[model samples]
Target: MKKPLIDMKNIRKTYANGSLEVEVLKGISLTIDQGEFVSIIGSSGSGKSTLMNIIGCLDTCSLGEYLLDSKDINSYTEKELAIVRNEKIGFIFQKFNLLAKLNCYENVELPLIYRCMETQERRERVLKSLEMVGLSDRLKHRPSEMSGGQQQRVAIARALACAPPLILADEPTGNLDSKSSNEIMNILIDLNRKGVTLVLITHDNDIAELAHRIIRISDGEITSSIDCKRGM
Candidate 1:
């Protein structure tokens, strides 16, 4: 049997504001396998973002066991975690998060630059990723020069350039029009079909329905998880 790609056990996160204490996660446990497309849906302040952060390795749980690819991530040092984040996972945000000054190709190549990849290899990977998103012709355009949908595509291309096994997207389609949203979702679906595991965080039911499985959260706990074979 193929082991689960992500195994999270009894995870917990808490924050304090003076005398007030907020518990964001109440012992959450989840397991996601390779090639799976999952959506995490929840209301505001329901800990969905916190969970996303933990899953993306951007933050650690106050208590719990998190294993990525069968290796315990809790034991990794900050530097090690940085490497894991860079090489194993890709992230997309609601705001597109592209550098304003850099052109499409340069923005996509940023990750490779951080990893100190050779210039030629970086260029090849960037171009391939851009091509995958059908944005090869827009490589020279800056963020301000593109529409919201185009900017998001560039962000997706940036995420893909590293060839990470896992992609964590937070409200990826929130800023786009219905047509653009569908386009981005189709891109994500195609990527998953090609064997990239994806975990999407969103409040929109329509967007969540695109995944093969859905996990609903409320009050910092998983309320239910349903398998939607229809692939909405």
Candidate 2:
């Protein structure tokens, strides 16, 4: 059997301020397999953001083992972590985070360009990713010209263009309307169906329930984890 895509053990995070050390995460351990859609739901001040930062390689835990794609990420240097973030993981934010001056195609192609991918392959990835999000026709349109749902789709396309093994989405639908939220969620579900490993950070239970597994966090610890078994 293939090893799980994410394997974390006894994870802990703490922040130090002068003489005070505040523990933000307390002994969190979880494993997510490849192709799994998992949601981590927590309210404000729950330490979920800190956990997300650690999972995304933007921060490290004070104590614990975190293996992503079977590699021990906690052992990597800052530069190595940056490379992992750029080449192995794709990130989607609540804000679309697209350049206002760049059109849809250009926005999606930006990461590939940074990777110095050959032009032909870069074009193929951008076009294929846009097609996946049903935005192939909006290639030349700017984010200002699209609806909220469309802009989020473009964001998803940008993440997909990297062909990374993991996708980290933080409140991806937070800025959209109900219709647009549903649209974005459905697109995410479809992507998971096609074998993308996605970890969604959200506070909305209704939105969290859409994922196959729901992990609830509170007071810097995991309160509960439910396997919906709703069929992946």
Candidate 3:
């Protein structure tokens, strides 16, 4: 049998603000299969973002186990976690995190450059990723020259350039117009159909409906997990 893509058991996260200890995640557990499309929905401060950070290898749990691609997350050092992040996960943030000065192609090619990919291969990957996002024609345009939607597309292309197995999108449509939001969601749906496991983090119910499974969280705990794909 194929192994699960993500496994978290009894996960907990806490923050220390001076003498106060704040428990953010309270024994959360979840499993995501390869090729699955799952959404984590929560209001602000529901620990949804905290969960996303752990799953993306950007943060470690204070307690419990997290196995990503069958490797123990606790075993990876900070440097190893950085490598794991680049190799296994693609992240899309609410804010289009593209640098203002870099052109679309340059932004998309950044990860490849960090990986030390050859010039020719980097060019091909960047072109292909931009094409996937329908921004091939905007390759030379800087982020400042593009609309919010266009800038977000560039961000998506940057995420795709590395071809990571899991795509973690945190409110990818938060800053877009309705038309642009739909376009972005459609692109994400297409990516899911093409076999990239997706985990979307959103507070919008309509947006969460797009996923096959919707896991709702409140007060740092899972309130509900609905499988929407059951009849489909």
Misplaced by over 4 Å in model 1 are: none
Instruction: Give the Cα-based TM-score of candidate 1 against the true structure.
Output: 0.97
Summarize candidate 2's per-residue lDDT along 1-232 as a digit string, tens digits: 6459999999999899899999999999989999899999988999898988999999999999999998999889999998898888889999889999999999999989888899999999999999998999999999999988899899999999988888999999999899999989999998888889999999888889888899999999999999875544
lDDT score, candidate 1: 0.94
Worst 10 residues of 2 by lDDT: 223-232
Model 1 pairs in collision: none
Regions of candidate 3 where Cα sits further than 4 Å from its true position: none
Q: Give candidate 3's error at residue 120 in angstroms.
A: 0.5
What TM-score should be assigned to candidate 3?
A: 0.97
Q: Can you write out model 1's per-residue Cα lDDT over 101-168, one digit (the tens) per residue?
A: 99999999999999999999999999999999989999899999999999999999999999999999
Candidates 2 and 3, the one with greater lDDT: 3
Error of 1 at 25 (Å): 0.2
Q: Runs in model 2 with CA error above 4 Å?
A: none
* C-alpha positional error of residue 36 in candidate 2 after TM-score superposition, expressed in Å: 0.8
Choose 1 or 2, whichever is better by TM-score: 1
Residue 182 of model 1 has an lDDT of 93
Report how far off residue 108 is in candidate 3 (Å): 0.3
lDDT order, best first, reads 1, 3, 2
Cα error, residue 96 of model 3, in Å, equals: 0.9
In candidate 3, which residue pairs get closer than 3 Å at backbone N, Cα or C atoms, i.e. clash?
none
